[model samples]
Target chain A: MSRPSDVYLFGTCLVDLFMPDAGMDAITLLETLGIRVHFPQAQSCCGQPAYTSGHPREARDVARSQLDLFPGDWPIVVPSGSCGGMLKHHWPTLFAGEPEQERVVAIAARVVEFSDFLLNHLDWQPVDTGPATRVAVHTSCSARREMNVHTTSWALVDRLANVTRVVHDHESECCGFGGTFSIKHPDIAGAMVTDKARALEDSGAIEFVTADAGCLMNINGKLALDKATPLRGKHLASFLLERTGGKS
Target chain B: MNSQPVTLYPSRQFKDNARAALADTELRGSLRSAMDFLMAKRSSAFPDTDELDALRTLGEAIRQRCLSRLPELLEQLEERLTANGVTVHWAETPAQANAIIHGLVAARNGTLMVKGKSMVSEEIELNHHLEAHGIQALESDMGEYIVQMAGEKPTHIIMPAIHKTKAQIARLFHEKLPDTPYTEDVDALIRIGRNALREAYLQADVGLSGVNFAVAETGTLCLVENEGNGRMCTTVPDLHIAITGIEKVVEKLEDVVPLYSLLTRSAIGQPITTYFNMISGPRRPGEKDGPREVHLVLLDNGRSQAYADQQLRKTLQCIRCGACMNHCPVYSRIGGHAYGTTYPGPIGEIISPHLLGLENTRDLPTASSLCGACGEVCPVRIPIPEMLMRLREESQRPAGEAVDHPLRGQGAAASTTEALAWRAWRRVYASPGTYRLFGWSATRLRALTPPTQAGWTQNHVPMTPAPKTLHELVREREARRKES
Candidate 1:
């Protein structure tokens, strides 16, 4: 199939509320590539928190609202792998035998994570006009298992000529954001996040980049609290936009 | 049915046990190193990824075939065993299994028994029963012996005393053994355990062992172990008793080959164990030396319950390999003792519910981060994360709600406040207008948001909402662009 000229953008709840710059940068990144980005104002959360927490009834209700928002044949690009996974893999399971199953099947087929869209769908490369910077990419658990974006992000980052990828240990494990899990089980969550932060710091990278807003928020929140820390967390859109000279 | 209830570890206090385990730095260090070593070994075991995937597929199919004809295969096994002069006994519960073994020992006038590593026996609490009845039951496996001497249960399935360091074992042997010099050298400790267990093997009146696979077509019991103690326990004494769960039976002898290979490789990275013993029957008339009489006990401790359900039957296909535990982040961090159950880690969280009940193991399924590590390493391809989610759903259902699943309404997620909140959330997210209204109010009241959000604020800075929603900002940006 030929690539579409325009696509609908699903700015997940985390990006919509806590990190609006990521949402804006994602659009700018797409628009700079000659593709029109459409934002559906009626779209809300992807209901991953409820679905993963074992509340399927609430999850179905929330999933149905967004399932109808982007009704066109345009690819639905999401900035977060976690929300993208929910849309692509989990939405059909939530509406298995219902009348909305067809809509879910159609919508799920078009859902693509941000990095995956850049590498696979658009087949576009970034123009490297920025300074050299060494960064480590944090691939969220959902990205590795639910979507194949974990490997695609490496390819996406490799497009920048001056950007170098730093190696780290335990790079594929969860950042412990897990939506409501961090709040419910604080001690366990703290232990996990602590391990993640130490591993990223040990890599000697100046910035930690990830495609998911939840992980960016969680890791950046922790890194921001420490005054002397050398590392900064950046979303894939912002990092790509900045490195490609698309950030105006 | 037996009258007295068997005493098993209580998983109801899992939270408390995990807290205690996390507090101990020494244990955390041991578990971390052990898990890392095991994971690395397993990764290197299968050099060709395609070959490994093929083996896993074959292994899963073998198990599925076995379970599909479980009842018929079990009866065939009993008939074959009876024809081969090996008596087969069925146990419906732990108490019943204990009673049957006790009766056999009493009939033989046995006073002492040496045991190989058997997780089924642990589930039945056989050693405690024998002790209560004034009979001596000793563990012959090195790790099991250490835990038995310390008056503690085996924390891990494969490595019973993985929680202990060499120094701790040296101290344990020094305190427990008479006239024994304290030595922490690995070889020295093995010599100490071997010498002690050798003496027990001769003096004991009965030899007991656990079966890794019970073949039905032929009445053969297969065992795989690195230590020679399993062979000695089954061959040293005149009377030998082999106990295993009924689900361990497979349809044919050939089916065990791939499963056994996967078991050892996934377990500890061994291409094959040091000893692979296959016992079919007792000593024949012309046989030189073997057990005079052999007994096979089939323990059904809630395995049948797991079998009755379609989705849950996958739990029984486990070959008792510790790969899941070796890869689990939670198990690696807290160690097995924190789970407070006979079995621990990812497998324990899923199967313990069927063995015990959901009420006792409600907190276990929630302990995982659901990172899918266990599922990725599982030899039989059991979806550990999916099962965990199913169990979590079962645990949260109301006490008596009607659901098609077998474990409905058996969980602790039935809190009224949480239900009401989810209902309210459904209302807000289901409607775009309602969601926008809440989003506007949340952005406006960002300063009024609480600084401490329950347990999260204890460590993390409070996560306050942003000043404006992305849609609101996008609208303003579009209007300015139009004017320009």
Candidate 2:
């Protein structure tokens, strides 16, 4: 099937700095399927921080910047479900009573969680992997509710050869890194993530896995913070590529 | 006991706790059985009626209206209650609430007060104040009495003993009821509870209960419940004390209908609770029962602060059905004890900080998955997750070290990791052209992303980015439609 044109990638902040490879990998995946991808130079955070925290003004600033940066209907795909969820669910809220409601409505129609996009539009099939390894999977609230991407991710992972996957026992729990939530409620955040790390250890998989890096970092940090007994955190993309001997 | 709060982890914490808690053979078996039973029963009671949704909408509207005129309604209630042979008192805080109750019982030359299930009583720790006065207040609701007898707070709002096993209850029964035979059967257990509380209800002169909805129209007080104790509390005593938060007042009886309807369905999945009692004035001359004088105590205690903020006023719409808590992932794991307060679950977390001061209850907000399930399951449809997140924000924005937040750095809005992540994200994908170019690059490197986004790829296969932009496809489709 011929790929649709002008695929735009809105790499969320967590993916851009902490893990750029996911961004690059996403681009490669699109191009291989014959779709040309574009990156918005001025793309910034989705202003979820200010929005979730009740700071409508700051969120408006960030959201307006995002709207301006990606003006005109391009199906904006974001790597992190956390960011994508914010754009789709919260940005519209920012415009509830304001003049920008029209802008919010237009953009709201264009945002999609990357996984759901691939599964729905691309009819994604798990690529042939050379080898399979044991892995565990975690689903975040963002993708769980906004996209239902968890099922899609699991289905794709199940297709890999030589892979034994352990799904996150608490597939819907939060990592407690709710934008500014972690730093503000550090102890609670710490306690919550410690619990998550323990779940990963209990998953019986060698590696703890999830779709969002923010959740991964929070869980991994908690594992380190408490010196949790077992299981280590890894991203979904990294685990898939490991079997194929692609990036890692 | 540990001084530090028990934590499962940060973003992933609730997930782990919920999983572990759900995996517990005993806990899950009981929880699944109970939750399903309650949900099924509730649905059966409502029977897919459009009236239920209409009631919920009306309930939401009534609550919103009540919240808007809270101060006026409260004044009206106070005036009406006092005129109806009842003493009306107002408490600005929990401490004040406790002290008022202590003074009232002390003045009556009483040592014991019988209480029905009032979460407000728990908030104010009225029992302790009474105990200090050498008075012993007894809990009368079967579930509440059971929880009290076990020396623990209620876990679930409606079914306080949901976390307990039959064996635990049998043991508790054995210990608490030395004279009665301890049994494991549910009906037998209820009989024991009924037998034990009957004595307390008959003996106590001053009965205390929570007002579910206080009507200002005719100086009326309403208590909704399945148990008979709520009825007996306001009816059986010579003097009755009703402690209510100000937000519970409704301007008219019609407004209360919708609010009360949602309360039952959301709680225990019931169409309507077995009993909804409306009490007007005290017993008149020649009256065979009820208190000679009724007392309504309106407690402010952080409710006004919540009302001051428009975004949060929606929380007042809650009917205390416990649906939000029942469906909550966080409450499922930690139960209510982890909250360390009278209120538990999502609603508790949101209101506790305001009631108990953020310093003592700051941890409550962090204990959520932000799953939005609570909002969905709510009868009044309170946006609990959204409110909880807002509390997290309120706690963080102040930049206090060990003031409102327990930890020195806890609740700070800015973090190096989060800030750094934001900085890098802003550098690209801000424009359509760059976004497309970047998408192409990601697709090309799909084979190599594991090493790139290692943490994310751990559990699931990262789906390759879509081959076609939905926008592009949509545009083409639309253009073709236009041509046709």
Candidate 3:
């Protein structure tokens, strides 16, 4: 598919509330690339938390609200791979046998993860202008397996010339921010995030960046609580924009 | 013969069990190292990603095809085994399977039954049941033998004593057996275990084993293992009784090729196991040394329930490869014992709900983070994460709800409060206006966000909302664009 001049930005609920700057930076990155980034004001959650928690009805109800929000046939770029997966992969399954199944499938076809859109669609080759520094990248499980955009995220990070991308131990492992999973099983989640944080800090990178906000919240939250590690995390979009000389 | 009954940890106590497991630094270190080793082995074994994908695809197709015709295949298996002089017994429950085996042993007046590795036996609590009837069931496989001697259940399906370190095993052996010196050397430990079980294999009146595949076309029961005990148990004793789930049936002998290849590689990173035994039936008149009497017990035990659903049926496609567990983040921390079920990890999370009622195993399904590692690594490509979500949905379904095929313990995990929360969540996110209003208040009242958010604040700081919502920021950017 050819690059489109216009795209819809589905700023996920986590970014909309907890890390709005990441969403703004994502918009700036797209706008700087000469693409019209349409921020659908009506959009909220991607219904991922509910869908993954096994409440499909609630998920479908919420997902249906965004079905018609992007009806212009333009690509719906999701900053979060988890939400993008919900739209691209699971939405049709959630709407199977329903009256809006066709519509859901059509919308699913147009859903593109943030980094995937940048690297694959637009062939984005970001020139690094920021100070030379080492950083780690944490790809969400959804980004790795569900959306299969982890490589895309890594490639975008690798495109930065002066920035050194350090690899962490168990880099592909989940940070335990599995939506309701962290809530339902705190001890297990805590153990997982603790290990993940330790791995990131031990990677010798000063900071970390992830494309998904949930993992950023999880790893950052753990790092904050531990206070033993100087390592921090940011969304990949924000990190990429800042690295590429775009205003954060 | 007078051994104590096996102790069972209930799945309901999963949370508490997980807490204890997490606190055990020893267990965490051991499991992390073991998982790392296994993951590396598996990765190296399947070096060619394209070949691995092709094999997994073929493996999945074979399982799905066989499962689609499970009923017919099972019947054909029974007929072919009977024709081959193997007495086939059909059991719908664990109790029935146990009774059938007990009757077989009683007919022979068997007092001692030597056994190979069998997860099915563990599933039915066969050792305890036989011990109750004054029959001694000795485990011949080294891992099973060690676990049995310790009077503990097997922690892992493939490696029963995997949870125990070499020092721990040496200690157990020195304490449990007579004249056994404590030895931490792996070779020495194996020799001691072999010596301990060698006498039982000779004196055993009956032998028991588990089948990996029961090919209907050939009436052969296939057993895969690195240990030679499976061969001994099936051949040394006069009476050999092999037990397995009914879902183990395949259509043809050749179909076992790709499945076995996938199984061994996915399981232990071995292209093929050291020993792959195929037992068609009891020893023929001309046969010199094999068991004279062979019995195949096919147990249905909640498998038919899983097979009844199109989606859940994929759970049966598993080839007993522990790759899923080896790659699972949750299982790596908690280990198999914490799962409190015969099978553990990703496979257990999905299959246990059907084996035991969802009411008993409700927590198992939600135990995963749904990271998709299990599904990704699965040899037969069972969509484990999707099945977990499906089971979770089934467990949370309202009790007495009208559905064509309700799970045994449907609505077991359902709570009115949780349901109400989702309902409220639906109201807010299902509309643009309500979501905007909620987000506005959330950002504006960010300071009021509690520092003591339950669960989340346990290992992390409180998650506070930003000062402004993305919507407001985007709107401001749009206004700037309009001004320009």
| CA-only RMSD, every prediction | 2.8, 8.8, 1.1
Clashing pairs in 3: none
> What's the distance in Å from true for residue A5, model 3?
0.5
TM-score of chain A of each: 0.97, 0.88, 0.98
What would the per-residue lDDT of candidate 1 be over residues B1-484, giving only the tens digit for each residue? 0112333457887777776777788998898899889988988998889999999999999999999999999999999989989999999999999998999889888989999999999888899899889788999899988888877888899999999999999998888887788999989989988998888899888999999999999989999888999999888899999999999999999999999999999999989999999998888999988899899999888888789888888999999999999988778877877777788999998898888888778778778777777888899998887787778777777777776656722856557877788889899888999989998999999999898778667556677888999988888889999999
* Per-model TM-score versus the true fold: 0.96, 0.73, 0.99
Error of 2 at B346 (Å): 1.1
lDDT of each: 0.86, 0.69, 0.91
Model 2: residues with Cα > 4 Å off, grouped in runs: A1-4, A17-35, A42-44, A47-67, A92-106, A115-139, A146-248, B1-55, B79-85, B103-107, B399-484
DockQ for model 2? 0.10
Best by lDDT: 3
Question: Model 1: how many Å of interface RMSD?
Answer: 1.5
> Which digits, one per residue and each the tens of the lDDT, describe model 3 over residues B4-103?
4687889889899899988988888888888898899899999999999999999999999999999999999999999999999989999999999999
Looking at candidate 1 chain B, the ten consecutive residues that score lowest on lDDT are B1-10
The residue pairs in collision within model 1 are B395-B411, B395-B412, B396-B413
